[model samples]
Target: MPGSITGTIVDPTGATVAGARVRISHRDQSAEQEALSGDDGQYSLPNVTPGPFQLTITLVGFTTQASSGILRSGENYTVPQIAMPLATAVTEVRVVPSRVEVAEDQIKAQEKQRVLGVVPNFYVSYDHHAVPLAPKQKFELAWKTTVDPVSFGVTGAIAGIQQAQNDFSGYGQGAQGYGKRFGASYANFLASTYIGGAILPSLLKQDPRYFYKGAGSKRSRVLYAIANSVICKGDNGHWQANYSSILGSLAAGGISNLYYPAKNRDGAELTFENTLIGISESAAVNLLQEFFIRKLTRNIPNYEPVSP
Candidate 1:
């Protein structure tokens, strides 16, 4: 004959735990009986096969409980009240920014950088492992550079100097001449900046920033800086020939022939000459960036120096 089992469930605080599942099983028998604790925390398993049996109680948010006892045939067995403890709490957190987000933050930092708090120095990155900019970011940087108030002031100053020296004499003299010179100079600046820094970089998947190599011997640093003009880091983070800058210079120079005086336009000869001049200027500026510019640049991030 089968037996019966009864039990009550509670929490660690001795409060009755309703809805707790109670399972009774005998090792010697294939049958198992189950019940759920009522509102009063009481449970009863009827028709349980009598033998060595185990009772298990389980509920959400509480630890499972088990009890074992011996039962005789046709006997009514009552299990001791089960007290369940609260389950331990576990939580996990992750705070990683996406690559585009990281790059945007870095760009924000770079935009604040200026030489002596005056001239823009947005093209230099102190972090060697800086994230590559997306196409939109490249254009954003170029736009920021070209539209800055300082850029206009600098271009106007250059035009004034050219006028004083009677350079680009085709523009003639007076306010009209100065206006034309100013327009031409600003156009050149805009063309070179966008073509070299944004457009070609976006298409070619290259980095337009100068990566500062602050460590190593003076000669090695000089070589690194000079070599950077002809070669640059690709978006893949590998060193590659700087076709973007080289071709951009040529393209910008070619475009200049349209606005400059007819006599000054040397066609392909002028384009190649301007390209060479641009490269030379880049090399010189890179040398300055390596040796002296960082000290003068304000709002620089406290980035760790990268090894050559």
Candidate 2:
């Protein structure tokens, strides 16, 4: 049955507010009928189908108001008076930020993720469905990793160990030798991280982050971890060959020839060998990420459990 709804708009001071737009929406059908208050602040919506309905009232220079009620067949229902307060002077600073900003926010969250509150574990995405990072964001993450204070500390420690073991005798001993070895170690780190994690991934449109797999059988999880070394999610959200990781290792190994001692410089065979080793290292890291890292890592987002 069809019915009618009537209402009046008023201000807090009880003065009638005319020209207020009113919308009566049927709750079930998601249909709406609209009218405007007359000079006397009266509004009437006729031929409205019987149903539970909501009324939204709006006017210039006044806060919006809402009223709700029910209408019966052939009924002329009068809604309670709708009040329109003085419109809020809201300076809506709507800054529609870019995708890069959104990606940066996620990166900032990942940067805070540390294992045992110490080591940065920023490359693993607990969010399996995380947005693909932009190319610049990929570089930023690699740069952030390379320049972290912890990275320097770790590299220095490695240099100290190499010095103790009398490795890389070409650099000789003393403070100068330590300095040289440190430079070499840091160079290797920079090459590997930017090449593999940033440059190649950006170029190939592949995500450099390892997606964690926390909800699967042990054997399947292990297999997933190992397979991740050679397969990765592309920016298009499809799993594909991880050309970025595989080739980046080879590229980094090739670049090592420019700085490392002649004996340390990897030739063609050695470069391939290093690439294989890098892949193995990646599998091991992914295994740790899947089983152990998240447990130790702080600030991991609450992610829905996913099967491999």
Give a tens-digit lDDT track for model 2, residues 1-308: 57799878889898998899999775334468899999899999989876457788888888877776657556799998877888778733334445467568878899999999889999988766566899999999999999999999999999999999988887889999999899989998998899889999998999999988787699999999999999999887679999988888888788878877777566799889878988999999899998988889998777654553
Best by lDDT: 1
Checking candidate 2 for backbone clashes, the offending pairs are: none
Candidate 2, 110: how far from true, in Å?
A: 0.4
Clashing pairs in model 1? Answer: none
Model 2, TM vs. native: 0.69
Q: Which regions of candidate 1 are displaced past 4 Å?
A: 1-95
Residue 173's lDDT within candidate 2 is: 91
Q: Which digits, one per residue and each the tens of the lDDT, describe model 1 over residues 1-308?
A: 57788988989899998999998765434667789999999999888765457787888988777888756557788888889888777432335456688789999999999999999999999977577899999999999999999999999999999999989899998999999999999999989999999999999999999999888799999999999999999887779999989999988888888999987665797689878988899999999999999999999998756563
Model 2 lDDT, full chain set:
0.84
